[model samples]
Target: MLMLPAMARSSCERVIVSADPAYPPLHWYDGKQLRGASIVIITRILTDLGLPYELRYLGPWKRVLYAAKNGNIDVITTLKITPERRSFLIFSELVLNNPVAAFVKKDRPPPFSKWDDLIGLRGGIARGNRFGSVFDEFMDERLNVREADNLETAFNMLLANRFEYVITGYHVGQAYIASANIDDKLIALQPFLIDSQNLFGFAAQSPCIAYLPAINKQLEKLHKEGFIERALAQARADWRKTPIIGKN
Candidate 1:
């Protein structure tokens, strides 16, 4: 493991990004620069592949999706592809399968046991996040879905009862509930149905696909080296020790 020097920072070819300060374990702002699990994984993959690139770090998820869709960005890390999006982007092999579910205040009756159940309920979800094309397409128009600026805010809204529920990753749900000192008020219920999801290397076409295969290659390497499990376990441990501050 070598540290990148000042001369190394400007070396890569441009890889488009929109990693604002919101997403965690995937992307984050360290009060100085963008860094996180996805960034670490992406950096290791690109560096190992000898691919030089720059990150755009767009502030909104919608913008990130738009950039990837329009060829404004070469690739977006940790995106799940669905049938509807396949027409616009190519995906690398699965980086990860994130579990998704409805997070609600504690002691509440289960409002969801199926995708169709969420359709009639008013809920919040981060814009551009998808469960699957079928679910995403339905979410696009059928549900009374409110768009939150980010996952934490969505959890905030849920706690405030601004919405009936919030659709998001189980990790995010757990983190937010713990971080906000709201575990007593919120609980993730019935994973209901599981989506065989993948955080794909989203590319506009072949040239970019050339770069993405390297990420899968590195992921395979990391898997064999036990890096993935250890990193995730570390993240969970760190998150658990960090206490909730204001919302207590």
Candidate 2:
């Protein structure tokens, strides 16, 4: 862990990176603080770039986006820029473009494909997630949708069979499923819907507009050096454990 002296806190201000407590591998509240791959990567970028930044706790997506758009907050992590968001904040070059998938308890239902596949399958989604324009627009009436205030709640709901399906970035789904040790309970299904990878970067057009390009430079540098991959590999290694389910 890194630490700064007491005097440094008053002398220099770390730009605030606003985070909502969802979207694992990007931003979420760990037991101690905001953490996940994107959080770690952003921290690494700032340290490597010699920039000072702090993670700010934002309650939900709406308030955080409001703060970001108004420049009340300096940055936001892992935003998928639509035209509306583009107007409010500048966007950095994407860090990781991860695929999204439908996850459900294995054996309960057949797989889903196409937009209408969600019919009759009560789907739980993290509120305010950008699942691409096509799916985003369709999420309203096309699917029987249940919104969870947070990822853990969504998973808990799914675990209880409250919803037939839940969707998330593929790797995050895998990590959480592993964390729950619920191999028989939840399985990431086939025909991953939606395209374009979920990318992490500084909020571009917002208050941090002047700062993102530099972070992008650092991200590119990290990519070239394979530092990002190495970092993620080390992170996953730290959390490896036997499945909490199915072993018995």
Which candidate ranks first by TM-score, i.e. highest? 2
- Model 2: per-residue lDDT, tens digit, 94-152? 66666778888787856566767778887897776667766777776587888887566
Writing each residue's lDDT as its tens digit, candidate 1 over 66-140 gives 656665566666666677568767776666556777887786645666777776677998756678766667777
List per-prediction Cα lDDT, in the order shown.
0.64, 0.67
Q: Clashes in candidate 2: how many?
A: 11
Clashes of each: 8, 11
Pairs of colliding residues, candidate 1: 12-52, 12-53, 13-52, 13-53, 17-57, 18-57, 18-58, 106-185
Per-prediction TM-score: 0.77, 0.79
User: Top lDDT: which candidate number?
Assistant: 2
